[model samples]
Target chain A: MSGASDRVPLPYLREAAVALRDTQQRRNLATATTTIRAKRAAVTAEMPDWEALRVAGAAIKAHTLANLGHYLERLEERVMAAGGHVHWARGAREANDLVRGLVRGTGAREVIKVKSMTTDEIGLNRALAEDGVRAIETDLAELIVQLAGEAPSHILVPAIHKNRAEIRTLFLRAFGIAPSDLSDDPAELAGAARRYLRERFLATGVAVSGANFAVAETGSVCVVESEGNGRMCTTLPHTLISVMGIEKVLPRWRDLEVFLQLLPRSSTAERMNPYTSFWTGVHDGDGPRAFHLVLLDNGRSRTLSDDVGRETLRCIRCSACLNVCPVYERVGGHAYGSVYPGPIGAILNPQLRDVERDEALPYASTLCGACFEVCPVAIDIPRILVELRHRTVERKRERSPLPYGSAEDAAMVGAAKVFARWSRYEAAQRLGRLGQGPFVRDGAIRSLPGPLAGWSAVRDLRALPRQTFREWWRARGAGGGATPGEHEGEARDG
Target chain B: MAESARNAVLAAIERATHQVRDADPAAAHDALTRGYRQRGGASLPECLERLEERLEDYGVRVTRTTADGLPAAVAAWVAERGVQRWVVPPGVPEVWLSSVRGVEAIADDAGPRELDGADAVVTSCAVAVAETGSIVLDAGPGQGRRAATLVPDVHLCVVPASLVVELVPEAVAGLADAVTGGRPLTWISGPSATSDIELVRVAGVHGPRTLAVLLVEDA
Candidate 1:
């Protein structure tokens, strides 16, 4: 919420490069990503019209975001009309404060939470802790992260980096148990988490969550989860506080048709998620007596303003992009160093914060376009990344103005002068081909001695071939008795 | 302290309303309704089409039938699956089951253990969706409580054609009076599924593994 603990302006590119070299992280990521990718492909392939549906889904979100302010107001009014309360927050601090105030009002000293990335983004748990209220994570992976006092690495699976043995250690140390007694089997671990959370769920009077989708027509908030913990959190508590992003609204309950299909397959590669709980306002005596909806803006409006980047808002937080990303797989989620960790985070975090502050993030992608291909909402992520890179470059240029006679400025001016003419361009290319002799080592430039050292640090650059394209063209023309323009025409025809 | 906190939130909402008034409330409301209609909600047939597309996308099988043949079809499905015990929602029409016999039918009010032990659960939907192939289950007489449909391994929901709505707005509008003035509502799209860290697809995580929807035509 505060700028003080916002992501440190550390050298993320350098750190990510180092992390990418870590064999264990790479292995874990490759295995996990490949498996998820295959599963998603298999599931999505079953639908003959998946592509058409994806296009429709993207168009709907784009249209909604274009008229976001109107929809948000409609959502607020509808919720109120349904006897539900709506709270608007400009930023994370306001959102967190609103939630804490609601919890405090309930006279609740502790609260149980369903897995909500929005809460993590706003640092809600930490804020609640500061106010002397304990917030317990009910989701298995989230509980492991909470016990270890770490930020979530992956959006879907928070403690994804930690293996079963590591989880056993965390549970043993945090809850006072023996690791030897805890089995690595998922069922056993899940049973243990269930036992651990049941007491908190039953005892807690207030529950906090993030909504997967909020229907504006009925003012009903829907939460879809694989575990039944969300159902318990939503239904069992005396009061329910749902912190949702402003972009999460669907106009009517029927709009859920597209997303209900898009989300499950893209997220967990499932036909349908296990538990989808929808609640409107409050129930007399069935579930929560009091309900509050905190609509969080927190940089969303800023993201919405950018025509190139606004498509990122359409994300359902499915994490399909993350699962297919080669870059995300190697570095894991922690390397992104944000609550949103993966391909989506890479482009999103930098834009949400000033590009100058989180500058290293935009360059963290390989531009393979896997994320774009699999994205349910059709967010052209690679295009956005390139645009962000241009923005970053412009910001850098603005920050450090080049003097007229400086070497860097002179070189830029000189290049502009030379690039204006075909003769000069051909001369430079010829010289570059001739100049490659010394740097060429067995046809590859493995090391660079100067300013280019950073790029050569991790990857080898290919050596320039002996003949320039112009020279080759000239030689081929001599043999064929054809001019370069003719050769271009022939190439185009072929 | 509790009263003060409530007052503070109420005050905040009041203040927010006065702080920003860029758009006309009526215009904003109309634009939203129109936009929502354009996005996914429209006619019952459109909604049903969307539901069928979504259901097939999610790997759920859907069948269309009339109310008279409903019980016979379900019985055949039960026989095919070798199911011995089937759970039926309390409000399902007597005519729908008039032709079926031999299988044990547990009422919707059956305990969680009883529902869990049944091979299948069949109930009439509070509302049927054509767009998402989803069935809405309010705590109505036939639909039963949330647990009955959820705890069973196989869930077969019957939706009469007349109950289907094209868009979420229609669905919400259809249920508005009931939800605001009547009872608790539940909207279900498909069967339950999950994918673990290994990305292994697992069915029946916390709810039914197989969800079969029979869209019954009105007589």
Candidate 2:
């Protein structure tokens, strides 16, 4: 993560522009998101208590995060008592080092992995590879994304952008799968992945994963999945290492009753996912013999300090918002340039990284409020996006005092002065109309000077006409807006 | 290095608490109004019927049987499927497999690799949630270990009618002992499945290709 975060990101608008050119990927995203949105709406609409469950889910996360220090300590104590080793890491590099060291301790040159955004965020595979240890992705979509040497494009379905034929080709090339063994059928592609990873699951000595929820009351770690790859990783391995962001902790065991209902229904739109595994440390005659829980911070504490941004931690990683987001449905996840993507990514990636980098991510959304409406934990994504935008502007203004602020800041100041009095506003309007002659072309202003230039760079602005609305009103004279004949004409024209 | 990291994280959390908290953590947690239903449902027979419906909806074949007919049902399934090797975990009623013939019954506790070689596994459960059609396994009774039911291509789970609960919360409330006692739990809803490929559901992944359930009246 440090490695990825260190590099300057291409602005989100530019990245999204490039992604928009890929019509095939856009089609894949649109179909996938639309399908998931319909499925989620149907399942949620059937539940009478869906809203109440969302409130409860939100409340549990709120309470846990409020007393996160207390719960984190409790979780650590309980895990140790249950015969699991607990390690703490303050950053992504530290986390990777801890996991890599654990794998080294097991003396295993190769390890299997469950699909974990936290691992991807930390760049654990790359870190492990540098140390001569290979981390093999076991989830079918993750395996596909890994084999393609690309970042995952979606949270739940990592290879959501890849079509069946693309997946078949990857499988055929990567696994040396025979055409008879693999086809464009999703079932056959899944079978090919299963057959390929079956041997690796049994042979691997160490496995690393991320926790869906870690119960602090009883020291249990839970993983929710459909493919048994999670089971293979957490169960078959001799040593199990789970890297959990500090925010995943649930205060009590019963809290799972709320989340278990909320998450599956929200994600993949299922009554219940096929498999949900919960292990409290190591158990005799079952699962991994050695259980290691690595509690990761990685800028989470900084995120927690922000009153508005802390709600980002309440996300259960459902990715429901992604399915319903208009921007995400079109531009896809890669445009966000972070492990987390879509609405959640826009807000989360900036908070989890440096303040200066990824400045435009907060502006990636259209703020249609679909994400906030579908969010199970009630994370007001729009409200947070607005807050991040303001914070971004403030940060820029603070860093560079250009008399008033940045170009945006100066523009706002100029507009404030223009609107203070009607006479100045009218005069300025006339001045603007006169000044726009050279720039206005094709019935739109494609470029502008100094303070107003950024807007014209990506989008065309409608040229200001010769007369203002006030002028039109003045011209109306005694012809009031309330008069039916005039009103009819105005309405028809509008 | 680990020790300092722990201390540093703890210190950071302490600082962050003042910025985010408006009330005490325990008090805020206790003050939460759990408006959703905690438990309570229809009659046991009605719950069992609903359980059967949900299990079938997920492609798990559920057989209705009396206590005495459970073993014959297992045998019939084994014969029909032509299962070659089966792992019967410890605590599974020995009489449940008494009628089965021609198949190698693996009774000893088998490791993952050994279970992977087996064609199927027949096991019991701790509880079954009728609402979600999930058979809960806590490595108790007939349920041997987590991997025994997972590694094999087929999983045959036995859910006694009386064990079926009406809701997920009820099933959760009943698992406090398993949680506190350091026992691992697997809530199997159906055969292993994945919807990751273009969001299309394709069943039969690494867990089990097929899942069948025997719903006995009393066992």
Candidate 3:
């Protein structure tokens, strides 16, 4: 994959950051994330050893990633030996072209697709349309997104942003379903979607999917889903194409045991998904006659090269981190302005692309560390964010030539000199206490003008206290016992 | 054209494999398996218990029986489900379903028309896994194709105890020969369901809503 430099420049993140401050976005996120968070917690709590399973799941992925090239080769060999074809795609363009070529080879005008985030990330539907191969999304939420001509907002529940009433309205308007007959009830909405997709599933000759995990040992690609639509798309079609990210590989089928437990709890918050379909290759007189597995790198190799940021590749797309993210709850997935959204998205998107362009994403988090706590794979998100920030700053410094002797630069040089001395730091703190009288109001700095304004926009900053700790310590007399008045005052002030 | 496409794909893989070998010839094929076993995740027995726990947790009952008793046990289970007709994979051991009085047994190879009329489908698994309680079916003579196990309202998969593997690697090893040979394989974990909106759990959205696995032990 070409770097983000080849796409849009970095300023888009700044624009998204501005949009994220909206109260409507925050409310939507808060309501949705809270609901998902509670449900996930309740379901995960059912497993007594969920934490242990999470550790195992993370270790398996780390081991697999370290030996990715090997497992991928094994997977490809097994897939090819099974009469299945495996295609390698370095980026979205190659993947899209490969899929288009396959569809054209089959002479299929339209193909039914199960929901796959990799496809969404690569804009597969649009690419297929350009190639005159209409891609119909059969997943209920995906159908809504496709019908609305919108991008998916969530990994599992793509149309989570749309409420039942809105979905009913969209269905009626888009599919010509009578609004008079439609009810706001979810079951009715689902029934409507089922009816609409049933014909597509039966008629489509080609089906495309994204695998949850690909076991290299057996060359099996597994797709777990609640709706049977994946089953229809996978089994009924004459030709089946599965697009998967390179990171989805697990070295063995047994590794699925840990993930199967972790993913259901993390994504749908289920004990087990209703349908976990695993296909090796083509079956005779049953399922798809032809099977294609598209192994996509699409910027993953770049992600793997970064020692600090490589952990982002461990994500299973379960969105457990997203559900627990305070920032994600506020901004929702769209505000990230990338196919990947939420806590993982914030760190991952900037790193996948040059962070110099997407600087706004690194600052998106409050550094609450909730994401790190909830990550099943234990990706150190906060650490990655800080590392990305350092990278961004370093890149900026390298881009701008430092003036040989500019006054501003010289002042910074002087300040660095002064800061090297402890006496200077102590004097500066004392000066700040005396100088704060002009700005301090009601024990809070209510407003800050200029670059510091961004910090004070949503929060009130506490004014500096009357006495510095050093001053109080000195006033107490070097080694004397603390007086009750002094102790009480310090406690009350704190 | 098919032959050419096949060769091209094979050539690409061979080239990639050669490159990997040149880069790291000592990379262990069994490294992942060893890692998984040592640090892969849960223990074999624990994984099996968890799988059974998950299956039962999802409202599916698990029954253990010997191969000789499988037919009677499955017959009784089918009777209990009130299913009048059942579809059996072409390779299903005939004795397993022979004793079911008055229940019509349809071959898995029966056209979609015949399968559509069946109440439940019964099949023997290529391998049964303890990790996921998953029944692996390759389109071998007895196992039937993917459609036979999926289309029916209820699916009764008989997994020989001896075939049950401790982990996914063990399962993969068992199926490696068939998989590498291009045999069509289907792995079933549980009944199908979808919850589109509001997190309402719905079952049997596309495939069988009810999945029954008869774990048969060798006598």
List, residue by residue over B167-212, the lDDT tens digit for candidate 3: 5556666776675555656666677665666555555566776888
By descending lDDT, how would the candidates be arranged? 2, 3, 1
Top candidate on DockQ is 2
lDDT of 2 by residue, A386-455 (tens): 9999889889988876877787777788899999998899898789778888887765788888866777
Off by over 4 Å in 2: A1-8, A179-181, A419-441, A449-451, A465-494, B18-28
Cα lDDT computed for each candidate against the true fold: 0.71, 0.87, 0.72
* Whole-model lDDT, model 2: 0.87
- Residue A465 deviation, candidate 3, in Å? 11
Per-prediction DockQ comes to 0.15, 0.77, 0.26
Give the TM-score comparing model 1 with the true structure, all chains together.
Answer: 0.72
In the range B1-219, model 2's lDDT, one tens digit per residue, is: 999999999999889887666566667777897998787558988898989999998999999998899889988999998999988887988788888888887753676678888999999999999888899998888997788888889898888887889988999999989888888999899988998787878998789989999999875
| Candidate 3 off by > 4 Å | A1-67, A179-182, A216-218, A250-262, A355-357, A401-494, B1-53, B61-86, B99-107, B110-119, B126-142, B158-187, B212-219
DockQ metric, candidate 2: 0.77
Give model 2 RMSD, 1 decimal.
3.7
lDDT of 3 by residue, A1-494 (tens): 11221234225444455556666546555666788788888876755566777777776776666566777878988887767998888778888989999999999999999999899788888788887788888888888877776666677777766666767888899778777898987767777776677667666789999998987877888888877788788888889999998889887665665686678778877655666677777665668889999888776766666456457889998988888877676566666777787778878787666545566677778898988887877888999888877676666556656654433345568789879997987787778668666666767776676645655665577776666566667867876556556654653354
Displacement of residue B77 (Cα, Å) in model 1 is 16
